[model samples]
Target: MQSTISYLWHTDDLLGQGATASVYKARNKKSGEVVAVKVFNTASYMRPREVQGPGRQKVLVMEYCSSGSLLSVLESPEHAFGLPEDEFLVVLHCVVAGMNHLRENGIVHRDIKPGNIMRLVGEEGQSIYKLTDFGAARELDDDEKFVSVYGTEEYLHPDMYERAVLRKPQQKAFGVTVDLWSIGVTLYHAATGSLPFIPFGGPRRNKEIMYRITTEKPAGAIAGTQKRENGPLEWSYTLPITCQLSVGLQSQLVPILANILEVEQAKCWGFDQFFAETSDILQRVVVHVFSLSQAVLHHVYIHAHNTIAIFLEAVYEQTSVAPRHQEYLFEGHPCVLEPSLSAQHIAHTTASSPLTLFSMASETPKGLTFRDPALDIPKFVPKVDLQGDYNTAKGMLGAGYQSLRLARTLLDGQELMLRGLHWVVEVLQTTCRRTLEVTRMALLFLSSSLGTDRFSHVAGRPEIKELKEASELRSRLRTLAEVLSRCSQNITETQKSLSGLSSELLKNRDQVHEDRSIRQIQCCLDKMYLIYKQFKKSRIRPGLGYNEEQIHKLDKVNFSHLAKRLLQVFQEERVQNYQAALVMHGQRMRMVHETRNHLRLVGCSVAACNTEAQGAQESLSKILDWLSHQLLQDMTKGVQTSPPPTDPYPNPEPTDLVLHMQELCKEMKVLALDLQDNNHVIERLSRVPTAPDV
Candidate 1:
């Protein structure tokens, strides 16, 4: 006779059986539909509303997950070695999410192997792996422990295996970390498609030997017997080469596995820490492909916290080229990239541009390129105009906050500003020092370029090269002068607005609950405005003024046409000095331009952040408008300058250039010292009060 339980269904076929339940294929008599019925040996399974059973037994009905288990996924030919990094991370995220849910409810899942984890394909076609088969699960606390062993043999904790399988009568209690151990094993299997520990013959036969190998080694050590029964243990820290994990990912994964697959439970990371680490990796890890001369270096993993210098050093280890020799060319443009920028930031800013190897080795000695201004330039400065720093700030502020959240958000923004300022100050100090160095180098070369007698033999004709060169230098100096002066004026305006607002808050500091927060924000604004103070430092260039004397001299030079036959006097040696001077001039120009860029970013960051509140939009609009107008004027002035000279021998009169650079050097020294000494910005930011709980 076919096995039939209740009259409501027919159980003509048996599906599967487990430790506690037997699944049977059944047909609903009323609906004439087929389904699977789970008949548990116990009286109940959790709490079922409409219970169906023979006598006191519980017959639970659940929708089958037709997609099957993670074990099946591992069994596929594509996943024969293991799931790919992307797929593995997906599985990890889903499993951890499920584990977190279980943890929140104070339940421990004793069985956490791949077989118990089921894959569900949602209607959107996204794969979601969920924890199933909760038969071995029990209510457990962090501090609570159970002595009963209730998991698969291979995945079970050693202590539980000793007590349950070996029947050793060992006095040990299994804590919630038992599940963590099982998880470690399961994840490794999902990643590498194999168990972590093994003996010479098999797990079932050499259980004791496998347990010895697991516990005897130090933390993170992988050991197993290879050939002989009593052979020495083979220890290795890396995954098998046949495994599909990239070297970069393996580096990150091995450590995590070592931590969680620890023999001692105290050494194991709890689910919370594990989730945090994995999520952090998901957030910061980026894989890049680096190629040089047809040789591809694949899977270059860079983190957000790493600087370009550090990344280059890592690349050097892989490739023989040192950091100094590595020149990155992206989209055919030689990258004038900063070593201090975050590797991820560099990657982000570069977009999909393929970077090539360097040809230029060695550098212009360190002190040549003086500090360009604006160190605390916001991180969100976009490559394109569409999603610039302001837009980024607006996006961040769009997530409206209230009460404690509001206070916290404000505090965080202030802190971010502070950190940026602190880093900027350090950068400024270096920039100032380098500026001084470049000034000296220019002065040194200027005398040589001016004293050269190579042109003495040539007939004096209306020198178009001299005129063009002098005009270009004058234009650069004029732009620098304008940037500094306008930056000061703009800062003055922002300060005026901020000072008024800060003063108003100060008057009611005692009555306000956010007194400290207000003070902190005030300090941040003060710190930002403090950058403007550098401009006021004694301008050794006499008003560091319009430098009109040089511009007037440049205008006087006649470059309209040659008066006589031009002489091709090959004075390459003499012109080399002029070239040196030219390089220094270019460096100095870039420094001044950098300041403008940084200032622009800072202004945009502040304007966007403050405009989130009421009553400041008009003031900010005026400030930004003034800035936009001034910057536009500066841009137009640049456009008016002649393009680069075609001849390399084009020379400018060095007297005016020498004086300007000398004065610049003196001013830079003073500015560098002043910036180096000013600890108030950091101190003030550090003093910003902590956020309130309420």
Candidate 2:
């Protein structure tokens, strides 16, 4: 059956078919890229009936391997027997690398045999080997162990065979080391063209092979021959007719196989130990370092078997410099180590001398400063004062409300300014808290680092003395923060009280306005009634005589309608007044709250500054006393040239403290001015004339 999956890949050439799945060569219609797709036969596998349905078959898509499996290559007469040492080494390295990656991800490829390894042809006609068929791969849990026997019989570890035979409940479980045993068997087959452990008995061969694997030791030599060496006869495996390999290659293979085929699992060499033992097969490279002035410092050695990216990492760790900031030079010419470059290729090309590396910042001292021409200098924007904005809003609102257009303009402008002020207050509060945190940390660090004796010598210096004075300034800042905090609290409380007062005032205003509207309506109705009565009286006289009762009834109905209409208009006016009052009260309350938050933030800043100042003051006092004692000792030793006439231990007045108080007073004066201005505005508002009584 043929089908297209994901509307991108179409199944075409059939690759192979297995018991559980069928492999097909698929191609991407849009990209024209080829891939190997394995479609699992759900019927063959034991799955739940509910999961077994048409179009629900499991499928896996993978990158296509141009060359077929290693087993196919090994079985072929032309290539199977006579593999060169270098080609064999390449295959071994690739498989080991793949296994290392699996181990890193906590996976075990239990069936690591020749059938599962595939070769791919590169653009340059180079062969690259890759591990495939993860059907037997298992992800191990932290405490998990494998007990059941799985994988091909010949490649299985002796422990697994033993466990399967004994069928004991208390048998110890195996781990990823079993896979290493399978690798040993695969490598031996690839090198010698035969299985190390051959089966014998027809029906009971499986158990017989397991017994030999458990009891017998691996052959010590590679020639597959038995010879008398010294006192005992040693058995060895010789390469088959087509399996012509180098003595060096055979020597390397023998020890690795012996280690992996060890009876004890703990004695088996792991991936890390294997890699370390075989690292000499990989290439190497050298990196050199030089300063901006072309002065050489040191050189570093790195492996040239990986990509250029990996080499760059080694460079960074060696020099303690970031890769981005390093500039590589080869033979006085700049060279960029692109990601695509092969580490082995670069290492071969690099001269006997190391490649020079210089930091980007190094060029600045060589009079080669370069700035980005595209960047423009930024211009500073001046901050807008909320007080000024408030004044402008108040001025606009005070402009006569006779014109509806002007009234709307004033309201919108006032709202915009209020929003800006609210945002500014929030930012200020955050800044104050951050500043306090920084100051506290600095004071703690200084207190911990400097001793009492050290403080005296340090404080004696002019620069240090200036810093001490600055600490006093910080005390003033602290006081300012406290004042601001108090002001904020006061403003918040005042705003709450004012909000209640405004609500009450609004209710009173609404009642008065409603009463006046009703009174005006009643007066108008009374006048209309008088006019109707006159008209009726005139119609009743002499020649114009009419029904007086009818006229009276008509007048009553007209008055009733007029009264109803007037009441409705009055109620609408009352609603409008109530809404306007609420809007004004809400705006005023927000303003007060914003101001309160700003003051609170300023208070936090002051408190932090005060704490820092207190720490500095105590430190300075101790220093001064120490200095005085030191001076007295010098005088007793006749070391004094000219001294002050005052007592040696005279008390020095704290001028810094006095100055701090003065600064606080100055800030208080500014606050007082603002309060006075607010008081004037309140008085003006109070003087506005009220509506006359109905």
Top candidate when judged by lDDT against the true structure: 1
Instruction: Name model 2 segments beyond 4 Å from true.
Output: 7-12, 29-32, 42-56, 141-144, 161-170, 201-207, 218-242, 283-694
Per-residue accuracy of model 2 over 395-473 as CA lDDT, tens digit each: 2211111112222222332322233223223333333344334334433433333212223323334633544764464
User: In model 1, which regions exceed 4 Å deviation?
Assistant: 1-56, 59-63, 223-225, 293-296, 300-325, 329-337, 340-694
lDDT of 1 by residue, 476-595 (tens): 433433443444455454445434433443443322333344334233333322322232232223432346434322322211001000101101221232234334423432333344
Candidate of highest TM-score: 1
Looking at candidate 1, the ten consecutive residues that score lowest on lDDT are 559-568
TM-score of each: 0.46, 0.36
Pairs of residues clashing in candidate 1 = 370-434, 370-435, 371-431
